[model samples]
Target: MSHQLSDISHQTSDTRYQPSGVRNDAAPIGVFDSGYGGLTVLKELVKVLPQYDYLYLGDNGRAPYGNRSFETVYEYTLQCVQWFFEQGCSLVILACNTASAKALRSIQQNDLPRIAPDKRVLGVIRPTTEVIGEYSENGEIGILATKGTVNSGSYPIEIHKFFPEARVYQEACPMWVPIVENNEIDTPGADFFIKKNLHALFHKGPKVDAVLLACTHYPLLKDKIQEHLPIDVKLVSQGELVANSLADYLRRHPEMEQRCSKNGRQQFFTTDATEDFDNHGTLFFGAPVSSTHIVL
Candidate 1:
């Protein structure tokens, strides 16, 4: 079911996804997100697999996929995945919960087989849930995510698959993404939404010993979230969890691992202004970043 190299329409010769270059196994791993948040995941990935090369794509111009409809998210995500395929990525990780919740399945089940079966696309939910139940001593965990993810019911479904006894309570923080993307996480303006969202989560269920930051963007509000929660509640961030899970996945699938190039190089791409991506990406990624401009 592997898509032939001829399948992708890499329109421009100057585009990074241009099909002219040799398509080989020693290609870069692709990391995608609706915006800069996924840079956090890429940061951890580089830490764990510094030897491998990575090409990250941030769809910032049309971001906040959390508010988009399922079909739109799926379509947009599929476009990015195809772009990665054109760039010769052997694997892709959707670092967006909204995209993962609404789009990953359709891409994996429907599109992959027809378009690029040989390439693998993984999501954050399963990896996060695989260990989430362990933190729920009371069998009840809280989920803080975007509206799309919360509406998708992905957390409860994935969590129950691993811990049937565990209860999942979700709160959709619609305003949080805007606040973080605006680089206002530390501002007083963010407190209202942060407190409001946490309050809603606590009211949704009994005392939740752990709260999963279901959206990658939420980690920027870690302190605010923690301050709003009980002292003992453990905050689970997906970057580290997903990174570890991916490391294990590569170990288990040697064929895929062997295909990844270990050049210790990293590349960043964005649909928005490259300067803006570098500025905000540096904030989320925890370092300086130089991103290239790309069209979908």
Candidate 2:
């Protein structure tokens, strides 16, 4: 399920745009996701870095990338990334976990150098993995994510790279995203799925003291998840972690920071019906969202 470099290089034609040439009209930082889940991350980014403008694109038309193959996810992600570049974005964040797991590396390694060497793209997994071990008392980390993310084994692999003694266990919650997207957080079905997945995760790794809600969409079900979680276990979400990481990143890379526009503006776009995106997006974003439609 892997694609060759030639397969995706054609999509990055506009990646060479220089920031200096467009400094007068600097573009907002791009935040992309498969659907509404990314709005959660965007919300935190706005809170921590309120001075900068941001553009968010959700590929709701071809979403639920959780079950898709690596090749398909990479292609869709690259296409969206290219769209961000065309919009004058010099930096893009793959806010979706499935995209981060399935496509981020290939896009960074193979496509960026040939197409947008000057541009930068980042993911949620690396930032979360870098600090995930510190939260665990015994280095027992449990991950609750989508099938694609779990199947990729990115968390365990990346965690091991940072914390060698850490024990990582994962449970794929395929039904959780659908439940959240459909606004079923309070329903019995939501509790059923949440308890089921948490049970599965703990059964395999009882020592898991900290559980990482690896999927952005999972935050909406936080209260319910905690209700069913063990009293002593810690629950970790990515929004704050990613926000802090981004702040540190900007501080470390002033060149990238200077390129980011700072009028405090925010725009939302979706590759699906705006009505649908706005309706569900508000719940994740914690505010009213007025979105426009865009064809990918």
Candidate 3:
């Protein structure tokens, strides 16, 4: 089941699939997202740890996992994790908040031991939650995310584990994702939705001094979000927090660090059209990207 760099060349009539020119025997860290949102996290990872090779897979064809059932998110995420293992990845990061909220624990606790004991999978939620309390002076935190992530209650649960004194408030921005994905962040429609959600979140927790953009895609709307936020409130995004936590994790576990390949190589794959992914992905990734199409 091992895949080589050359395998990326195999393509259908409608799409072009290109793999990295580097060799694949070395283990690269895998980054999985339900769609292009994960690119923001990957962008930070490369900035902080550019030497490590990375494989990013976006399940674009079956994306918008935000509202899916927990069982369905887990199933889709596990399948993508297996694909990363087949491609010789020793570690995978669930960069999507929805996937992380719904699937990460199940995969780490229930599936990894049975399928690949030596391999590891991490998520964005824990890292963000670990230090979220420090950003709030009032001990009141707000979470803005998709319906699935807010419904999962993962942030409140995990944040309590580390910062028991913190009170967490959540608001599901159902229209935010669609606004970002449609490249409408600069429009009046985007402003309306962003303001609506922010108002609702603050209404639930008026004393909230810090707000976490619990969804990866929300970072793209940071500017607009900040414009509507109270002047003193802090806006916390997961990209830098997750990146720093990952660096610390690798430092603490040299065995896992040694398992990661460091050749500065990166590859992108999508379950939908490469052209569309590349155009939208570049916006999120902060760099021009060319992606290959994958079926699963």
Candidate 4:
């Protein structure tokens, strides 16, 4: 049988569902990442919108979506997003760069209407691109992301839309994910990869005034990235920017805002076992995520 938001709402109506940090009236916002990377986005969400409820789904079993075909990534992301909707999520956020590049549009256009009229889906790329244009001093900016994201040219496209004069340079750090997953963020080889990417960007031109960390996992290597940057180059991260954007978006869309519960809390799920998810997720979220597991 297919599940619906009404099913979850009716079950909780009789009982007081206490919202901890976020809005209490609406269902939780669904967040999806290929693996633990989305934790970077989650951390900011909890910090900036603490009053909203959140449901996080990490597709750990079939992660590294950066290498997958567009069709495969789209299908996989759609499945996860649909599952979140069934679990009573009024909004879904694609915290993965790869998914945002490959699947966000198709899901928003086709899947959201089928789930709920008020339902919405968001992605990380546009938010980052939008923010970069506002903050960049010069018309030039740099982006360090996964191979898929760079290949998609999402950053440059969004940047051009906002700042026609902007010059966007992209460099893909394909190995950073594995290093972060292994907790080797500060290892020598990690430094080498970080420096290599930074060099590639700087070599493009001195006009690059800001650098956006296009991958969620890139934040884990922020310090190393900073070390290799020019003193004038500003670093833009998606987590905080995306969180703030959501807050602004909600405020402007009162209908969506009013549906959100001010007393909501964060709930986590993983395609793999909860134990493994908790361990690795803790490393990513910077705190223990004691939540249930749901296999995808």
In model 3, which residue pairs have backbone atoms overlapping below 3 Å? none
Clashing pairs in 1: none
Q: Candidate 3, residue 93: CA error in Å?
A: 0.2
Error of 4 at 196 (Å): 1.1
Superposed on all Cα atoms, the candidates' RMSDs to the truth, in angstroms, are: 7.8, 8.3, 7.2, 6.0
lDDT of 3: 0.88
Task: Write one digit per residue (lDDT tens) for candidate 1, span 71-185.
Answer: 9999999999999999989899999998999999999999999998799999988999999998878988999998889889999999999999998999998898889877788
Candidate 2 lDDT over 159-232, as tens digits, reads 99999999999999999999988888899999998989999999999999999999999999999999998899
In terms of lDDT, the poorest run of 10 residues in model 1 is 1-10
The CA lDDT of each predicted structure is 0.85, 0.88, 0.88, 0.81
- Best-to-worst ranking by lDDT: 2, 3, 1, 4
RMSD of 1: 7.8
Q: Is candidate 1 or candidate 2 better by TM-score?
A: 2
C-alpha RMSD (angstroms) for model 4: 6.0
Instruction: Give candidate 4's error at residue 15 in angstroms.
Output: 22
Model 1 TM: 0.91
Model 4 Cα lDDT, one tens digit per residue, 1-296:
11111133333332222323234446778899988999889989977876566788999888889988899999999999889878877778999999999999888887677766578889998888876877688788888999999998888998898788888999988988888888888789998888887888788866888898999998988988888888888988899999989988876676666556544367788887778888888878887676576776
Which of the two candidates, 3 or 4, achieves a greater lDDT against the reference?
A: 3
Colliding pairs, model 2? none
lDDT of 3 at 12: 16
